[model samples]
Target chain A: MTLSIVKNATCTFCGCVCDDIELHAEGEKIVKTKGACSLGESWFKHHTAERLYPDALIDGKPATVDHAVEAAANYLYDANMPLVYGLSNITCEAQREAVFLAEIIGGVIDSHTSL
Target chain B: MIYWGGNPAECHPRHFTKYSLTQKGKFIPNGRKDRTMVLVDIRETPSAKAADLFLQIRPGKDFEVITALRAIIKDQPVNPKSVAETGLTVEQLQDLVKQMKAARFGIIFFGMGLSMTRGKHMNSAGVLMLAAEMNAFTKFVAMPMRGHGNVTGSDMVMRWSTGYPFGVNLCRGYPRFNPGEYSTVDLLVRGDNDAALILGADPGATMPQPGIDHLARIPTIVLDPKVTHTSRISRVHITTAATGVSAPGTVYRMDEIPLPLRPALKSPYPTDEEVIRRIREAVAKKPAWRPSPNGQMAIV
Candidate 1:
């Protein structure tokens, strides 16, 4: 059995936003949690990925990260009327960037939570 | 207000430990013992377990409950059983109503379970009304337990940046808002979008069945640090550093105070801010990249 401990991490998953969380990371994978609520524990323990890739499919075909970025950029840039949504879930810095992106595209910007 | 909508115990585990009756808020120094905690819900919850009194109401009976409470506060004869299908007896409800009237300083907090359920914004409206009514009786306030740390901040920043709040249109070189017309659920459910950029949230897990089905048909981009229902299906699933924990930023507490986010861990992905910056750089060359009246982004 392996054991570890750490603290003072915020849980980004919910509104409570518990800022004190402790996790037992067994070499990159979290196995246990201390000082965290059940929800926070579940969030840290499960915040792992099963795959690692920089490239993805845009419309059912494999594309490079640059290609996808360019494509998404073009979609916003070329549109006469566009809406950029989804901000509440990310950090404020990301939200600021999104606002900048929306401005350049002359598009609408919104967070999904406003609904 | 009532816990009629959400079960905070299962969702927000530390609410009681940090802010509710069990916790000693700055005002209520005596904590649970000093405060009269009244719960109105459809079922028993962990938070209710510690309440001084509990009133189990029907699924969609919040409106009725509020009306009765208002009547009681006004010194009118309100029969509790006549108000709704709630399981609480008249005497139990009247006692709770009296406590609410007598509270020196009280806060009514609710969750998404209220907004998404039968009453929708009306439920919030009613709760807000209760707060107003209670003001005449005692010091009382109602606040929504906004789900994300900065979810409320998102709206605040958007509102401050643009004249309108959420669901605003910038295509006309100005901001315009129409709730259902530009809401996320409506946008997805109506299939009005050709592509989507999912950030921070997993619409697949949070959206209703119809909205989820519609999102599945579009070209979607996801920015998340972990695997989620939306990220798994997105065309470009770009991972990012967790905002509050891995990247320092700012957020608004439920009380509308802007709190600085503290980072506690290192991350491999770019901050949501960085990704947005990159995307903004890629799109800035467009023809209509004009700043708004507030010097923010405006439709050109």
Candidate 2:
């Protein structure tokens, strides 16, 4: 497999968010990483492009993504007090969406900091 | 430099080499040799080996120790017997105060060990007070050693959008701040919430038994690249692309500096942002929960 090299790749394993890593990827797997600590190396190599799990699951059973999203929305809308938690390990863009979701649902939004 | 209640050697492996201690900077030409490192923890961790001095204090004594240090720094009288309860002698505190006063520049980097203990926010306030008091003698600052990727980003985003950092309640059509009441663990343990949408974190593995049980009891939804502990019990689980791995976006450093993420591979899964947007779109089709300035729900 031909290797695709990405320079200045950021590692989001921890709070450091070291952004000078040089990642060498063979297909979907990261084969080598430079300037990343051991923890970061493992984080970069952990995920792959393989579809190992179902796209979505409802009540521990495989379900379509559309079906799962609708179920999640209904539960949140039906609840008297819903919660949107855990912004850690995610992108800032997603975090923004979570805040908006919490507001529309009239719920509480918290992060790992509150723990 | 003071590392209090944090083990950067293991938790943040590149912290010492990349940001502090051993980094060769224009101000400190000799790097590690020119700087003094003082570590304060309940036990000697691997990071202690790198410290010039390691002060082991009794567990849950951070507030007491900090109070004693504040008094000592100001030359206020503190009972030696009471000071001993913190596992450090008055003489040691005095010496530490002297060093802090004489230093050209100093910084205290505290971690969860101080913030999540008995006193919780009070302990963090104590450290901040100590740092602020030290400024009378020299240039000093204190910063928290934030854990988890983009946690600081979350804080920053919440602050800019809601005027508060964490534990924000928008139930009243406006943001409200209250830690013990609105915080995750407290709400979960108290069973205050009926539903939860969890992302990026595994509270099922990290929270207390009651919190975990409350999560299982509720209609929980989770989004992650893999099936996590929380996902197992959640009512719905969606496999989102891993951030900084196959999902390109932005994340913040511990110091609140934002950086772009360059992904190296393409994943089959949708990004968390995409999935969340889809959910929001789905929810919009339903009836309005409350009247707002916009006929449709505001995105902000």
Candidate 3:
């Protein structure tokens, strides 16, 4: 087994933003987390491929990426009162894109900021 | 001076310890001992352990309790037994107020415990007013202990772009703000939205049961790296890179200070910005298009 520790990493699990985390990675996966709370440790350790849903589905059926995008766009376009929510966990760049979508569709936009 | 609602020890351990409690302020020469802290909450929290005085009040009595404390601080007589609704007598509250007046510099940090309870807005305002009133005899400031790393960032972005922080309606081609009417929870609960685009939060796990039920019936689109309760029931789930991890991007600190991120891993899926931009492009056409009967789905 190979072993390596990445230092000065930030734990994204909580608002603490504890920047002193060290991730113990074997190969490409984080196996353990140091300097993290229990919540952050679990977030990094268990967030592996087995826990992720990677397929794009439309109407509960698997669809191509392009089809998914078009379906999403169509959903927003046809919506009389569209709700664009959740931008806190993404990047500023992504948030800007979401804002662009909200403006184009003339929808109401909010995030967990108010939740 | 006071922690109105939040339990900083559990929610914001680092921030509370580093900046509010243990850290030394300019006027308060001692790092931790110089400041006399007061805690007011519905129950005992770990933060209460740090308080010089703990005022535990019944839920929804925050406004009444704070006002009574303010009255006593100003030497205004309040009915002793009536003010005792907070489980603290007027004399005990007056003692805390005396300490507040003695402090060289004081600050109150609150959280959702106050904002979500009854008299929500007024509860926050009352604490702010108390802090301001304390200024008559000493220096005091009030601040909220905001949750989530970038909740403050989300508000700042919306304020800069749309001139509103949250619950903004753009149906008129311009931004309009109405908190209760346009907010996400209200829209979901009222079944007002036809479609929802969830960017990174797990509202399904956090929203009220009614809101969650309505969301399940809607055409929901989710963009997230992890499979959350929101994405589990969403009509479409796109795996996007985590902003501060696999995708290098900028995130504002809880305090609204911007911090640049450095990616620790090569992202397998596209970044959220790229995915959102593609969706925006697809929505830009004036007339919507549909594929032919025989047409097949293609890659984005």
Candidate 4:
């Protein structure tokens, strides 16, 4: 088995965000991790593109993301109560959506930090 | 020279080994040997074992200890008994103050042990005050050991956008800072919220039990690259490419150092930015102004 080494991969598990991890991948699987702590090691070694469900769900029914989002917008638009939470773990760009959605719908917004 | 609260050995193991504790410095070429190490905590941590001095204080007594230290640094006589409430001796406090005053450069790194406990704000202020006082005699600095890959980045962004960081309210087209009233926990537990649009966060696992339970009962939309606990509970989940892994992006460390992410493989999933942009576009669609049944111009 040939190991393909990839260096300078950042571990997003914790606040440290250690960027020195080197992944040794055998085919599509990460075979080993170097220059990383246990947390970093486990994350880089196990983190993958596995999806829990392929189709986006609107009330448990399969639908495209756009369709689901449309449904979500309708629900939120009609609702008297709405909250926009999370957004801390995501990219800065994605967070803008939560903020925008909350403002448009006259809802409250908060992140994981409130925990 | 002093590590208060945080366990670098666990929270920031790489940082401890690579930068703070063992790394060689220009002023101190001998690395660990040339510098003094002090660990202060409520319990023994791996970092304490490596420190030259370990001052295990009573929990919630950080404010007292910090105040006492500041008093000593300012040439004021500190009441040993009062300071000892933190489980340290007058002699130890004196020695610590003396060492800090004598050092060419002194530094303190504190964590949630001080910030998250009772008197958190006071404790933080005490440490900074102590560091500032020590500057009169020697160079001293203090900082918190941050968590999350881009928490600092988030703070930086928040500051740039608003005058504050975290718990910022922009409902009025203006930013407002109020931690308790507008914070996530308060908003959720108080039942002031009904729906949530979760992006890159997991309050399900981290929030208080009440907050978590309430979140599960609400209309939550989770946007992540992986199937996290929050995503599983979300009514609408959109999987995106993982930042710093399948997607090339920039991440910030605890100290706000930006690092470039090297993508190991290209992801088939959409990037977070794209999905969010699409959602925004969808929500922004509004009916144009139209005449009502009576021919009066009214928005529909």
Highest-lDDT candidate: 2
Show model 1 residue runs off by greater than 4 Å. Answer: A1-7, A22-33, A48-57, A60-62, A79-81, A103-108, B1-4, B25-27, B75-82, B85-93, B163-165, B260-265, B289-300
Q: Assess each prediction's global lDDT (C-alpha) against the native.
A: 0.68, 0.91, 0.77, 0.72
Candidate 3 wrongly placed segments (more than 4 Å)? A1-5, A48-51, B25-29, B70-82, B132-137, B287-300
**Comparing candidate 2 with candidate 3, which one achieves the higher TM-score?**
2
Which tens-of-lDDT digit does each residue in B104-200 have in candidate 1? Answer: 8777887765666676667777888988888987888887877766777777777777866577776556677877677778777887766667777
DockQ-based ranking, best first? 2, 3, 4, 1
TM per candidate comes to 0.84, 0.96, 0.87, 0.86
Interface RMSD of each: 3.1, 1.4, 3.1, 3.0
Per-residue lDDT over B40-142 for candidate 3, one digit per residue giving the tens place of the 0 to 100 score: 8999988888887888888888888888978988899898878877677887887887777888777887788987888766777788898889889988888
Candidate 1 clash pair list: A89-B200, A93-B273, A94-B272, A94-B273, B173-B299
Error of 3 at B183 (Å): 1.4
- In model 4, the Cα lDDT at residue B142 comes to 90
Q: Of models 1 and 2, which has the larger DockQ?
A: 2
The collision pairs in model 3 are: A66-B300
Tell how far residue B58 is off in model 1, in angstroms.
Answer: 1.4
When 2 and 4 are scored with TM-score, the better candidate is 2
TM-score of 1: 0.84
**Model 3 Cα displacement at B285 (Å)?**
3.0
Q: Which stretches of model 4 miss by more than 4 angstroms? A: A1-4, A72-88, A92-115, B287-300
- Tens-digit lDDT track of model 2 for B1-300: 999999999999999999988998888999999999999999999999999999999999999999999999989999999989999999999989888888899999999989898798889889999999999889999988988989999999899989999999887778999988999999999999999999888999999999999999999999999999999989999999999999999999988899999999899999999888888888878776763565343434
Q: Judge candidate 2 at residue B104 and give its lDDT.
A: 93
Candidate 1 vs candidate 4, lDDT winner: 4
